[model samples]
Target: MRKFSLYMASICLLFGCEETIDVELKDAPPAYVVDAWINDKMETQVIQLSLTQPYFDSSEPTPITGATVTVTSEGKTFSFTESQSGSYTWDPATSTDRIETVGSRYTLTVNVDGNEFMAESELRRVPPVDSIKFTFKEERNAFQPEGYYAEFLATDPVGPGDTYWIKAIKNGIPLNNPFDLNIAYDAGFNEGGNIDGVVFIQPIQDAVTPLNEDLDEIVPYKLGDSLHVEIHSITHEAFTFLQQVQIQTQRDGGFDEIFAEPLENVSSNIMMMNENPDVQVIGFFNVSSVSGRGRKLTE
Candidate 1:
């Protein structure tokens, strides 16, 4: 009875120390977000414009409509007409549609309500995806039961300063998780690694494989599953921006993230035309050369 009384008293003390404190956060103005990534694929290109919302708002982003968008490369301008709310698109007529000379800078301009925003990017070269192979595996654990695992194969170009974003699509659905983001600098990660002119490292080559339900590493895909992989060459600035975004969004909750530094806003390449920049633009613009290949698991 004495011990039970002490336990009750301890629980009361612990409960008494807990109190709900409402954190009053200051309101900040909204920033324009531009998601403009053009690739040299025989498909329609799209650019989405939207505004940022409050930190705690769980609603959809407010789209910016009635905006004029265009891209110019090698003295030739291609207009992007508004297709729907906040989405601007440009269609390619033929498979051999070439907007302009490669390796030249492409400038993007957006006008919204008399305010102008501009960004520039160069279409970098990309290497072809060689193949996608599947390997059979036995039941390893609950997360990774017996299934077929896939591996993407691609060789980087023989030049440094080349960066790529490896995109994986499973059964037509893109693997858009932050942890699935696979960006490469030359043949390895980051610049100045002295690694180039070779095949992509093992980890990157296998990035097309899907992750388990926990978003952790596990064997993904099975018999009759389909996988598509694409490599999109990106600019250095875009690479940096994506790197920062991945770092900020990819949190698994552990000791390493416990002492992590406070989150900072990722930098953007888009700039406004106003003298004081009344409305800031936060996003990246990149033109890329892409190579992709698909495979279906049958074994």
Candidate 2:
């Protein structure tokens, strides 16, 4: 009887009980997504509208059309014309001298199918990039042998709540990876560092380099590679939004399976004026003053 029980136990360990449970996932109604931005430049401002799709659906989100868009600031209103299917443009060349000014607040309003959404942002001043420096170092677990990387030398203005978004362009190609998203809450290396009025720290400086998507590694630049860095003064809300986006992008298979942030919608500045609960909106509206500098890597 003991031998028979042992054999049964072995069998159970090898091929235990199994069952398939059916999960019914109800698809939520589609919501509108708005991508709006206004920079301190003498150019046309653009607003893009689209509808969100299901998670498993592999198609592009449908664009919203026939919407009326307008931007207002300091008692002046500039209307936008639909230039494409889902794109609206406000050309300051035709109506005004410039659309955005430093320290000026702007409000955006969009009316679609009798539903109205509004957002407001201010164009803040960005510190200029004094210079860019590159160095090659050999370190443990490095991707390349004494890989080359660039850093910006710029002093952050003395302020507690100042935020910046740094963008890197390599040979005229913009780096758009989540790993390449570089943002600074203050002059410090990370949040609450309080290293104000000084040069940005090493960790923040190293973020200017691009990353390899396949291996999830930082890619170093080669000699003669042209690098352009643009630093934009962003609102605290915009900084928070980009931080959340970075978290979402970094959470992949293993880490995501073990410890992952709960899936939540990104915060949007746009709001429905009618207080309609049924209508959902996504994305953000941003206004920024940009400062940039470029350099060619050598040695």
Best by lDDT: 1
Per-residue lDDT of 35-58 in model 1, one digit per residue for the tens?
999887778999999999888888
Model 1 segments more than 4 A misplaced: 1-21, 94-97, 141-144, 217-219, 254-256
**What does candidate 2 score on TM?**
0.86
> How would you encode candidate 2's per-residue C-alpha lDDT over 81-156 as one tens digit per residue?
8999999997777875465577788899999978999999888868888888888867546554457877887778
Q: Model 2 off-target regions past 4 Å?
A: 1-24, 139-145, 189-191
lDDT of 1: 0.84
Q: What is the lDDT of residue 225 in candidate 2?
A: 95
In candidate 1, position 216 carries an lDDT of 59
TM-score of each: 0.89, 0.86
